[model samples]
Structures are given as structure tokens and as C-alpha cells.
Target: MSETRIVGLRTERGWTQERLAEVSGVTVRTVQRLEAGNDVSLDTLSRLAGALEVPLRDLVAERAERDDTGNAGSTDDIDDTGGPAAGDDAAARHFADAARSAWRDIALGVALLVTSPAPVVLLIAGADAGLVPTSVEVAIAIGLGALLAIALVATLHLVRASGRLSPFLPIRQERVRFGARALRWAERLEGVHRRQRTRATAVACAMWVSSPLPLIVVALIEPGRGQGLWIAAATAVLLVVVAAGAFTALRTAWAPYVQAKLAPAVEARATV
Candidate 1:
């Protein structure tokens, strides 16, 4: 098998390569190669253990330590040391592949969003450029398109950042030791996410309660266009809520699949 005992142990716990990288600051590729074999350089192994905050022997140990979970089941029964329990290997493999290709995906996504503005420019400068039949439609499209573009660009950037930061994300370990070899990325993502959501909910409620101050500002500046400005500002606020709420929901829901992927890595680290 390509994977070593350490890899299997790590998978049983759940952790992503990215998380391991973060805790260890080793290159993702190094994690990849080491997991594949027992032949890593001593210097690399020492650093990896140090980053995982564990002893070198813990990482290279050949057996599972006592089951603190006390579940009375072998590793296979709880979940395959092969992958996260939430999905079949195919699904886990998919995200792993995506993570590997993250830079390319982000690059493509950005290129598309950046060039999206071209269509509007074409409409304005081409044969149909002179069609000013309804200013309102053009204006509305402009507002929505701009907002959509902003959202897309922001989303793509976020994807790239997450991919890069994933190496060291924590997985569900018995404990977050100074030296665990997290095979999984995050164990308590849902709990962490819930706390953040609560805070956001409070902030949103506060903003909603004080919603009209922008109108006052615009009205003071320009009586006629004040309502439009206020409406736009309100739309922006609503967008923020929707986006934040949606991300929170996904974080909680997809927690299983994501956590599953990294679980082995985390478990591996715990022992290593």
C-alpha cells in the first residue's frame, strides 16, 4: 500500500494535508511523500514531529496506542482509516483532487470574473451600443452585475485562501496536542462556526434596527436621489446577511464531509 501505518492512523483521526502543513510548516508535498513511505530524512522527521508537537517515535510508531475513545470497535468499524466517514471514497477523493488543483481553479475563476466586465463594455461600444431604449433596465443591470462581480471575485479569492490555509487546519482529535499529526483538517468546525454565527446574528440585528441612517445622509446630500441611495445601501446590507448566513449554513452542513476528509490526518498526528 502507498500509505504507511502513520498515514492510516492519521486518517483514522481525520486531518488534511494542509492542516498538517500548518502545524508543521512543512511543504504539502513533503507530507504527501512521507505519508507514502517510511523513508523520510531524519531531519525532516524531527521537524515534522516538532511541528506536530510530538516525539519522533510517536510519528513512526508501528501500532495503535490504547483506544481512549473506548468504542470497543476496531478502526474499520468506526470509519475506514482510508477516509472520512461522511462520504464514500469517491467524494473524499474529489475534494482532495480539488485541493491539489486549487491554484489553477482560482486562477481560472478569477480570469472569468475579471473578463466578465467585457460583455457590458461590448454592449456599450458595439452595434447595439446606441440602444438607450430604457435607462432603468440598464441601470438595474449595472447595479446587479457590479454586485455579482464583486461577490464572485471575493468568493474566488476566499477559495484560494482556504486552499492555501488548509494544511494546518485541525481535525477532531482526542486532544489538540502540541505534537499530534492531524490527518483531519478540523474537528470542531461546527462549534467554532456556531459561535461566529451567533456573533454575526447579533451584529446583523443591530444593523437592521438602525437601517435608515444612510437615508438621512443621502437625503441631506441630495433630496431627489436620497431614496435610491438608501435603497442601494439597504440592498448591500441584505446581501451581506445572505452571504454570511449562507456560508455559515454550509460550514455547519458540509462539516461532515470536510471533517471526514481530514480525520485520518488528525488521528495520525495524535499518535505520531
Candidate 2:
């Protein structure tokens, strides 16, 4: 492919040479050389086109046309069908679904962590008001503790499952189909930054931490007081805000990854 076409495509996507190199599995030096119109091997060209989400022939043909006519072709002449091979579309769909499911799993974990204290709080309140016997409260606490333990286990398992996938490792078909879809999706996704995953995890933790604050505030305020309703209303508002913030943050962090991961498959399908 012509260096100008490669450079144009990369710049149009706002990709730096380093970013392109990382996504294309090439060295930064190689990217620089290619951009400078140095000859690149067929394999290298193929990688670049894949990473840039364009057809290989389009790059080669555009370069050939430019050389023959002594005029660089228009950007519109380059085919933008940078998509995965046809056979990969099914795998891509599965990975996308898995990524989405993993997010839900994480959300469920956060919900469990956030709500874990509710039973205990209720038990304490009931005992203080002489509405519950000591024996019953003890039993309830034990049950809730067990439930919390189970929730924690499930949460950790999900987190581990969603951890980063290693591209060098051979992934089993069953795993791709049934487990760790998040990792699979990440492996397939181009241009996913570590910061995005970190931010998403942080936001989820923050949501869990903040979720109980409203209930704690309500507990500190006397329910027998005339302001109980006001306290409840305020708590509801706070919970809503926390939920909304978590939703927005998680979506912001993961949406790009998902879109990038699926772009090739989507484009392939479109071309068909």
C-alpha cells in the first residue's frame, strides 16, 4: 500500500504511529518506515490493513493506481471494509455477547456487595425496637452471612473470568463459547486501552461503596421523628444518583471496547 494512503487512514482515525503499531502487532519503527514510503512486506501490509479496518486489495490497488497515474487517488477510492474474515463473524458475535454478559455479571456483583448490609441493618433495627427476638436475629444474621459469602465468591469468580485475555495463549473453543467472554472480546478488540478497564472497575467499586451511604444516613436519623419521610426521600434520590453514575461510567468505559471489537464483524456483514 502507498505510505500516503496508510498515513491518511491512520490520521483520519486519530491514531498515532505508536497506537497503530500496537494494534497492528508491528514495531513503532516499522510503522514509521511504512509511513515514510519504505517498502513493506505483504504480511506487514496485511496486518496494517487489518488493524486499520480496511481491505488489503484496496490498499495495494490504491497504491498501484497512484503510481501508474502519477496522482494520489482520492480517499474515497479506498475501500473501508476493514472487517474480519467471514468465518470469524460467528466467533465475534459470541465474544460480543460474552462481553455484555460479563458486564452484567459485574453489575450483579456490585449489587450484591451494595445490598449485603440490608438484612443486618433490618435485624438490628428490629431488635432495638423489640420487634424481633434475639434467637431469630442471630439466625437471620447467620443466613445473611452465608448469603454474603456466596455472593462474594460469585463476584470474585466473575471478576477473574472478565480479566484480560492473553493474545498469545490458545483459547479453547468451549471457553470462547461458554466462559470468559470478556477476555475473548478484549483479545479481539483493537485499540482498547488499559485505562478503560481500570476506570470501569474503579467506577463499579465506587458505586458499591457509595450505595450503602444513603441507608446509613437514614439509620442515623430517628424513624419515629416527623422527618422520617424526608429522610427516605433523600435516600431514594441518593440511590438513584449512585445508580445513574455507575451506569454512565461503566457504559462509557466499555462501550468503545465493545464497538471496536465488533466493528470488523459488523463491517464484514455489511459488505456481504
lDDT, each prediction:
0.46, 0.55
All candidates' TM-scores? 0.32, 0.36
Judged by lDDT against the true structure, how good is candidate 1? 0.46
RMSD of 2: 15.1
| lDDT for each residue of candidate 1 in 165-216, tens digit (9 for 90 to 100) | 3432322222222222222334455355557546655654565555555545
All models, RMSD in angstroms:
13.0, 15.1
Colliding residue pairs in candidate 2: 53-82, 54-82
By summed lDDT, the worst window of 10 consecutive residues in model 1 runs over 170-179
Candidate that scores best on TM-score: 2
Candidate 2 Cα lDDT to native: 0.55
Off by over 4 Å in 2: 1-90, 135-140, 143-150, 153-254, 260-272
